[model samples]
Target: MKTSLQTTAFAFATSAVLAAPALADEWRLNNFLPETRPESAQIEKFAEDVNTALAEKDFSIEVYHGGSLGLPNTDLLRVVPTGAVEMSLMWANYLGRDAPALGSVFVQGAISTVDELTDVLPVAQEIYEEEYSEWDVTTVGFVAIPTLSVSVFCRDEPVNTLEDLRNVKLRVWAREQVETFERLGVAAQIIPQEETYVALRTGVVDCALYPALYAKTISLQEVTGYASFLYPMASAPYALGVSDALWESTDPEIRDAITQAADDLWDRTNQYDADIENEMAARESLAEEGIVWSEDFPESDRALFVEAVSETWKMLAEEAGGNALDYRERMLTALGR
Candidate 1:
């Protein structure tokens, strides 16, 4: 009886979601990040453009910030396809556990510089389209998350090199990271971003990988005393995924507006690299708060880390069981590896 009731509830939720778009003459875009984020502003602008373009048609695009629809970021793979949300910002890296083929295509942690990041994106975008197309989710545009430097923070030990991480338990965000570190013979765990400081304070994790620009946002300085710039951390931009269901029903004029907005989304951000100045500013701020900066990763170690992470990427692709291996090869060739 309980199982049947749960199934009924899910069915009702699905129906309600499917019905929301056309009947209301409004297409909802679900962005899980808060409105205050720099990227959210662009998304809002995208919606406004779409709504304005469709003004004559009695249709509108509504922007819901901070996951107001109560959707988990990870569930977007299925949600967007099913029209649970007409559109959404899906962080490909965050969805790795579910779509290894797309998610692990390029682990930003594996990349060391902005040029390398640039090289990988075209390949990653292809895989995203190929795999997402398999489920009928269209990749409209992307918001480029700048190449914020990755800082390895620890409470007691300073992680300046690969060898330095050996004695400490690292807290990484994804299983691929956990496995990559594990392959290096270090004990690593997956800790949610919100609980990282607590985990560090309570001795649950000895180190964590965080962007240097936002370390203070999570109060990493309060618990961890030392940090090192480990990599450039050019994370895959948030993908603007639109459902085919909604797209097919929309007029071409409205589609052109969305396409133009998305194309301009990338161009708008290309005006400046948001992280370069901010990361240095953050480092100085963290230093004032008593956080000691350590030597950045040596080229030798960066190369080593890239290799370890690459192995995990291959393993993920092979296990994902589709055109994953083929996609992985294209990614490697793009990287010139």
Candidate 2:
């Protein structure tokens, strides 16, 4: 009996020793984008950087990209809460069904540039945190792709003016995009980004609207001939949200390390966009690679487009059940509008 008691105590001590190592060394993170694209490349880099930083502190992390661990793009909010997965970089707009306020952000055409968003991200972050926390999610930091400036990349007909928007079959990614483009008379069809090139090549779509980064990343410039500089009407940002339960379980030091690295990436991304000289250089490079950019549409024409969508603010406010109106007032008050 004495020998058996000693063996039992030894086994218990061994189990405790094993559990301590598990607590120190293992982690899993998910990124939903394909590695072929530039923005996705940046996300991969961020993950690698985090892993490297943690390793320097005698820890390690495993990163699953392209939704390798699971279809995080569609199921993370569900999976994360149940501990099916640990961490993720979530795009707010895609989670619209769960978080309507996210989609509401795209309602107005006023926030045209990254510079404008920089001032407003704090308020947006606060709003998202409040909403996401209900689902047991936490936002680590936001990663923005340099202006998702939508371009009408057409196969046969290039859209140069507002009149060209009429009856044009285009691919749209968001409901707000559909509504706003429909108001401009576009025959919009919703489709995923992966299918856009095939849709354009097969004549299923006459034109498609997406970011310059996407165009450059996927060689969409080869299928389309011209781009319209519709600045405000076509700009957006992507965000990254983490699983709150996972965050709470993480060692506070590891959590701080990841958050700090993500914050650095945000600053890097913002710097990349804020450097007008670099953006101009990128534009020139893309132009050299067969992308045609038109300078024909002047400020007055741009103003006309904004004027045409003048009721967006009111419509959005109504859609947001007065909260959007509150947001709008906040933005306007910030700008002294």
Residues 25-89, model 1: lDDT tens digits = 77788887767667788888888877777788887778888766767676676567666677788
Best by TM-score: 1
Model 1 weakest 10-residue run by lDDT: 1-10
TM per candidate: 0.84, 0.79
Task: Give per-candidate clash totals.
Answer: 0, 0
Per-residue lDDT value at 135 in model 1: 63
Q: Which pairs of residues have clashing backbones in candidate 1?
A: none
Sequence-dependent TM-score of model 2: 0.79
Cα lDDT of model 2 by residue, 1-337, tens digit: 3234334444443442223323446555566666676666676667777878788677765666665554435444554454344566677666655455556554536566665666766666666666567667777777765554545666675576767767578887766666666666767887767677788888888887765645765567777777655644323345566667677887888888888878877877764434455446656777888777765446675676565445555565567664556655665554445
What are the root-mean-square deviations of the candidates from the true structure over C-alphas?
4.1, 9.7
